[model samples]
Target: MIAFLKKRAKMSFLLLLKVLRFYWLLLNVWHFSRTKISYEAVKWRNISIYFHFKSKIIKYLTSNILSKINISLNSSNKNFSSYIK
Candidate 1:
């Protein structure tokens, strides 16, 4: 009976650990979802400002990398420009 009780105690501990792990994951997911929703709820002007800065950084990085690689941004093809417009 003591052995059975010990086994039951071990099982209960494992179950408690599993429940704690599940709650931890649930909390993390809830936090991320809340963050995402709050970010999305931001004003369009603020979001655009964020994106504008992001694009500038990206453009700077790409331009520097491409220049290092000797790749020209200005293509001689007029057809490509027309197609883009």
Candidate 2:
């Protein structure tokens, strides 16, 4: 009976150790996944901001060019009309 009890105790101890190791592995996996997700979020946000700023710059430049063209056309029309008169 004593030998049987000793064997059972050892088995229980080994089971407990295996459970602890499994939990440790699960915790590490959870931590790594969370970190990876946060890193990707930040990286995508920066890329979106960069594209937004680039679009704004292009819009501003095009608008300026259009206004300048309108001004030059109006001036030329006035000069031509005056010359004809």
Candidate 3:
């Protein structure tokens, strides 16, 4: 899994965000359509899922960004050392 991500390192971050949004929307639709939904239950569920989804997106995007930044910085340092020699 990590290897696959490393291979596709050039994919745009916006695309990943769009994919996550799509999945979240699908889940939200499913939750809204539940036959057992009540006013209070729906409100509670919406609040919980909203926070859960927001946190997951933030965590994922930030992790990806940090990983990419680390990789880029490491590569630049390596190149700088080679250039100095």
TM-score on alpha carbons, each prediction? 0.41, 0.51, 0.52
Whole-model alpha-carbon lDDT for candidate 1: 0.76
RMSD of 2: 27.0
Per-candidate RMSD, Å: 18.5, 27.0, 9.8
Judging by lDDT, tell me the better candidate of 1 and 2. 2
Candidate 1 lowest-lDDT run of ten: 70-79
Q: Give the candidate order by descending TM-score.
A: 3, 2, 1
lDDT per model vs. reference: 0.76, 0.85, 0.84
State, as a TM-score between 0 and 1, how close model 3 is to the true structure: 0.52
Q: Write the candidate numbers in order of decreasing lDDT.
A: 2, 3, 1
Name the candidate, 2 or 3, with the larger TM-score value: 3
On TM-score, the stronger of 1 and 2 is 2
Highest TM-score scorer: 3
Which regions of candidate 2 are displaced past 4 Å? Answer: 1-37
What tens digits encode model 1's per-residue C-alpha lDDT throughout 1-85?
A: 9999999999999999999979965865676688775545444545687799999999999989988666443553555787989
TM-score of 1: 0.41
TM-score of 2: 0.51
Give me the runs in candidate 3 sitting further than 4 Å from their true place.
1-38
